[model samples]
Target chain A: MQPGEQRDEVEMLSLMLLIRRFEERASQQYQAQKIGGFCHLYIGQEAVVTGALAAVRDDDYVITAYRDHAYALARGTSADACMAELFGKETGCSRGLGGSMHFFDRKNHMYGGHAIVGAHVPLAVGMAFAIKYRGEDRVTLCFFGDGAINQGSFHEALNLAALYKLPIVFICENNLFAMGTSVKRSTSLKQIVDRAEGYDIPGEIVDGMNFREVRDKVAEIVDSIRKEAHPAFLEVRTYRYRGHSMSDPASYRTKQELEKYRLDDPITRLRAQLTREGKLTNEQFDMLDKRAKETVLAAVKFAEKSPEMPVEQVYDYVYFNGAKE
Target chain B: MREITYRQALNEALAEELERDPNVFLMGEEVAEYHGAYKVSQGLLERFGPRRIIDTPISENGFAGLGIGAAMVGLRPIIEFMTFSLSLVAFDQVVNNAPNMFLMSGGQFNVPITFRGPNGPAHQLAATHSHATENFYASVPGLKVCAPATPSDAKGLLKTAVRDDNPVLVLEAELLYSSKGMVEPPDEELLIPLGKADVKREGTDVSIICYAQTVPLALKVAAQLEEENISAEIVDLRSIKPLDEQTVFDSVAKTHRVVIVEQDHPFCGVGAEICYRIQKNIFDALDAQILRVSQEDVPMPYNERLEKAVLPNADKLVTAVKQVCYA
Candidate 1:
């Protein structure tokens, strides 16, 4: 699209690698007892948010469920901030009150990392409602897992979004399972995108593993959503390499299925695409991989060194202004 | 000053705020076109237009959370519940999302939204419809809760809530919609700060601490107790939370005996919290065990007679004040 288009693609490859290495490091930190609470890794599904963020403008809002390190990273939040959030330090995003599950970057227009299955869907709709109310051209991209579609809140949000003809997209990252229960056992739809028909919204299924495919499809959907100012549904059918949380043993699925999906791993595919384009040499790829690991290593170190929020100031943010004052 | 009903006061406050700030808008079931379920928002749609005075489907959770989301970026939304009993469907938004947004985000966002409309009992609306609602939001950290017992208070607290940089819930009594009192004109900008209580009828013997629907009840009880030479001070806690304990404490100090009256149930009610605070703060000032005249702990019955039986009555408050006075 630009004279430096290949460089941008190579830069995207670096971002995906950074997220992969960052998530791998976070897992180690969780196991080592540095990061507490439920750590849901966005290990395999980095391409979804990576490409989705590429399609949206900086002012357009992005909100997602708890599996959100990649989303935060892709939205330009520092590795230091994201890592420090998991470590529960004052320098972390959310000032360490929300650990692992809630990563909020207000400046970046990333609403938050909401933990509830379908709670944030309505919130995203409200943001989109504001955009339309103000007659702005911004579109909101709301991400949730397959399980969130079953929630009454999700259905209500879908109806309101379509009815109001708000500029918003509901991106369903169908990673097959909601914690332990598979999508088929929970959601009624055979194809998750078909659920949009019930709300009279445009729906599509995209290959989430390929970076270019996710970016192109999401960009197309976003373009129309912005133009017509209508809501749309996008089913990103990807898989997670790890269990739902760190606690999940993943006994719900077998090794063969995992290996089959890993064969078309998102990062590997993107890396190969760059390789086939003759843009990325083996040495350059190794250097980029090493750079991601070093950045993650430094992020871990920064997290380890950051101080925890003091107990005395715990009441600081309870209200906008002090009631007693 | 002009005399107006509680419903009129609310309508004026909303109109003034909508005119004062372009960002402010009203949204809820029957809030527009229908003129509100209780007619509190009558004539707002014609004045403010559909953009500001909007109507919503009966999707409470969606709309409530939607209001919070609208507030997240920067819009002051007044989301009405028609009846706060319906708010139970959106409890997560009220208790979790709205209140917790400010705190959870490290103060990154302030949900400058107000959730209002008819709250508490109205006629024989039975158990499911009539909820005191204070129990759900009273103790919520990031939220401010206000209940106005009179027209002036209704207008003042609402305007204040609209301007306040926090999520506020204004619990209006459905029964008090038609009840009239003096409220300042729109230009007066009748703004009552939250966390303050009003002393409605000053007395010396026993304090009748109450709010919302109970403020009128306490005033009636105060009148009934006056004939028997019992001068009872009435502490109308207009703002339920960030509670105006100083006013309550001052009232209790002047009137050693106390009788807390609430339209809602007794167990773990707002009265119970007030009782705990009074004893803990001014134990020696309390000459008698602070008694409470409250609705009996049972589901509201549709039978008019049984409903009257469940609600606090004049005789119950008279007996309660006399017992404390005698002790």
Candidate 2:
């Protein structure tokens, strides 16, 4: 591997590790009643975001559904800010008003972690439209799950984006389940990409489990999307190691299936490949893993030190224009 | 400079905006080939092509949410609901998503989009179709709400709404589409500033605050009262959300007695807000209690007679003004 590529992989692996450890701690906190409201983890789908985000530009916009903590962190949100948001702290990303489902950092151009299913898709399209209208060269990466593809907003937005040739990339994280029902029961089209034909946009299916492949394919499409100034759809086929959220027992899938996915764990494979190619030393990998865990621990410490959100702050940040006091 | 119907003024405003800004586009159900349900978008598809002036599906939530999203990235989208009642289907998208996006994202993006459509009850439209939600929509903080009464206001307000950095809701009156008046020929682009009320007619006896369709009814009542030597000032509340309380207060201060006329039911309506503001700002100026002339508090009936019986008419304003004057 090239030295620069090796360095990039290390950085990506570090992010994946930080996200995994952060979520594991978050799940524990939820069970212990330390964290409140709903909590969805990206323990399994870390590679999909780590790889996809690596291919995009910082100026480019990104939007996603409620299952969005991963994308927010990958897009440049601090570990402490995300943890504080999950803990509902005053210093959180949304100032603790939005909780886990609505993590947002405008400074990073990361549109909030939306709660509505398939709702943020059109906003992504609109963002792209704005780019095209202004005659700017920027592509938007909108991440959504298989569940959102069935929503009317998804279809209408896709059709409109195609019709207008908006610069948007629709990334479908097809983890095969919508809350509890499998994709088969929820949709007639086995392949989510099939819906793209109806909108006249190009579509592709990718192995979301492989980080390098996901990154290579995303970079290929995202680069062209910037040059072409048109939108494309990507269906990243992957699995979720955890349940839908903290409250779910994950009764939909079996332990064997989970174990089968473990064989292709993006983090494990990437780390092993780096070690085998002599791109990384065992001691170096161990230190990097330890540092990622320490970072997560430090974030937890920071979140724990923060004060709880005041009840009255609930009504704040409702309007950015400051129309309401 | 050119005399045109309210519908024509709106069409002129849209066509003019499209020509000026490549970023501004119009989209909604039947906004293109079908020429809009109200035909306000007629001939736009031919002028701007299918891409810029497009038609969408009947999914209100979907398209409304799309407009919000589209606005965030940089495009200015103009969405149309057939009427205010149909806007309820996308209430979550408008009230929750679009308005909250900027603040929630900590100013990451601003939705420069407009949701325009006919608002309030029309002849024979029942509960399912007839609704005046100016008050409901105005309550939301991030959005700007405007109800244009004249052909000039329609053209001016729509031009301003298209360029606003925040989301705007333009509520058009279905009955006033055919009303004719000369529009200020899309001369220099002017905003006509939001929350400002226009005194359509000046008087000293009593003040009648109305907007949209009711503005004309109040004007007619004022003209009829002229024969009786009772000068009634008609205040047109062009923008309801950022209400022009000063204009209403100034008129109320002079008139002493005041009456509010609205097509919507008075219960928790825009009329109530006008009454509340009048009492709050000019309590000493009033000679008596403020009277509200509004549609009867019930779903609009389809029968022409029943519809006439409930909706605010010149007769109702005449009676309401006399009551306020006598009190």
Candidate 3:
């Protein structure tokens, strides 16, 4: 398919599969202590990031929570920097200042993988506010988990964004749980989108596990947001296959329940659909799978070879000042 | 040059900045409609309209985080907390996000935002509403903290802060808002250098070091002591983060006596840093022990008498100066 072609279903499928395989490999590495400190994997929720990211332009800003490897990869952070960041090496996106929870690429307009639950939401609002205030037509895509919706900053940002009519697309990936607690246990309102009505902004629920659904919904809303210069909210209902971090013993949810949700694995479902529609051959699928494996391996190798930041470099990037220390 | 209240100078600076730069705007509770609770934003809504001068909900953390986020995208936002006391609700945004964003983003973003408004004890507003946040904010590396004492410094420092490339905390004195001083009208292009001290008064007997409201009190005390044949030099530390200790120490070295006055409680106050640096650098130069006159170590009281007693007022400052000079 031509790169300019209106996002081919096969390409969407390939992107989802790539994110899945990359995360699977990272999960293993994290378990082995190769990827240290607060690793939140996006295993079951690949479709939301993959689909939503595909719908937006490169100029649009994308920021999300700590469960952000998939979102970062989808937004064009190189596999090399992504894996290196997970390794806490100097070559990482944040120069090893932010390990897994704070991935950032300013040039690419990917703001952060902010660790604080609802902190980045306001940042997204501010970025969109800047775009509108400057008379520029740009959108800021802010993604957060279900738990973030309950935070005071989230409501405050949403209210300000709504009041100013800032161009922003707020994507809430409601993956059932925040760390260990379920959304139902945490929030009185089961559907997080219901909270948006309090701000007088439009809100909708998307089957986050479905690539086409997320892509179509996001594309429709993003296009309108660009035209209207206002904010929109989308709650992508999804799930996570692994524990909150790397050290969990799979105690949050039952294996049977996990297996039930795994039936709709975004990557497998997309791959099967692409083959059925003749958009991709089994051989092409195999080649893509092989390419993904090689890419992950190369990233691991690059990170392994990368030098650790010197003791002096520990405080180097603490401030942007020109001093080495 | 015009003589205006410190509040008016800040208002003028904000209005001029908004007109000069399209990227500059103001956000805070009662900033737009109520013409600013303290009237610092008076007539701004009528002048710049609703788009630039925004009134926010009583949500400091939200608006503060919004200001940080907006700054990251190249918009210079001036976020006002009605008082420094309310800013504790937004402390995480100030310390965590505002400072960490630039470094965490690998220089891809700059938080060119100013979180300003009156800081320090204000009348009998009680414990929750009275606070000195210079030390709290200065402890963070990615931030630039300024506590301007005079109307001129407030206007100049605010203008510089708005145009700075980093997140700046402008600690305005609530009491100084009504104080009149000579201020040059807004020079949008002019930038006052940060991290410098202003020698408000020159003397040879002892050095009275302070900033914000305490500087004025120190200066008044210096004047009263002048009749007693004692001279006191006054150093108003304009910025706290990149502390201007040289100017302070130079005075101390010349005078051989030092007295530090601050509006905050003595424990871990902004004066503590000045004392530490003074002891470390000019221990032998001091003829008398460095004396610090600060607020009493108690939650700011609501009663006027208690509030006055708790704060470092002219009386406390004068007493400290006399002790330092006679010791």
Number of the top-ranking candidate, with TM-score as the measure: 1
lDDT of 2 by residue, A105-134 (tens): 877778879888888887787778777767
Off by over 4 Å in 1: A1-7, A322-325
Candidate 1 clashes: the total is 0
The residue pairs that clash in candidate 2, if any, are A123-B69, A126-B70, A127-B73, A130-B74, A130-B75, B1-B185
Q: Provide the TM-score for each candidate, comma-separated.
A: 0.98, 0.88, 0.96
What candidate 3 gets wrong by more than 4 Å, as runs, is A1-5, A310-325, B185-190
Candidate 3 global lDDT:
0.85
The C-alpha local distance difference test score for the whole of candidate 1 amounts to 0.89
- Which residue pairs collide in model 1, if any? none
Model 3 sits at a Cα RMSD from the real structure of 2.2
Interface RMSD over true interface Cα atoms for each candidate: 3.0, 3.6, 2.9
Reference-based lDDT, residue B57, model 2: 75
Residue-wise C-alpha lDDT for candidate 1, range B190-249, written one tens digit per residue? 889999999999999999998999888889888887887899999999998879999999
Candidate 2 C-alpha lDDT tens digits along B185-255: 56756457778899999999999999998998888888999999899999999999789999999998888
Higher-lDDT candidate among 1 and 2?
1
**Candidate whose lDDT is highest:** 1
- Which window of 10 residues has the lowest lDDT sum in candidate 2 chain A? A316-325
Give the DockQ-based CAPRI class for model 1: medium
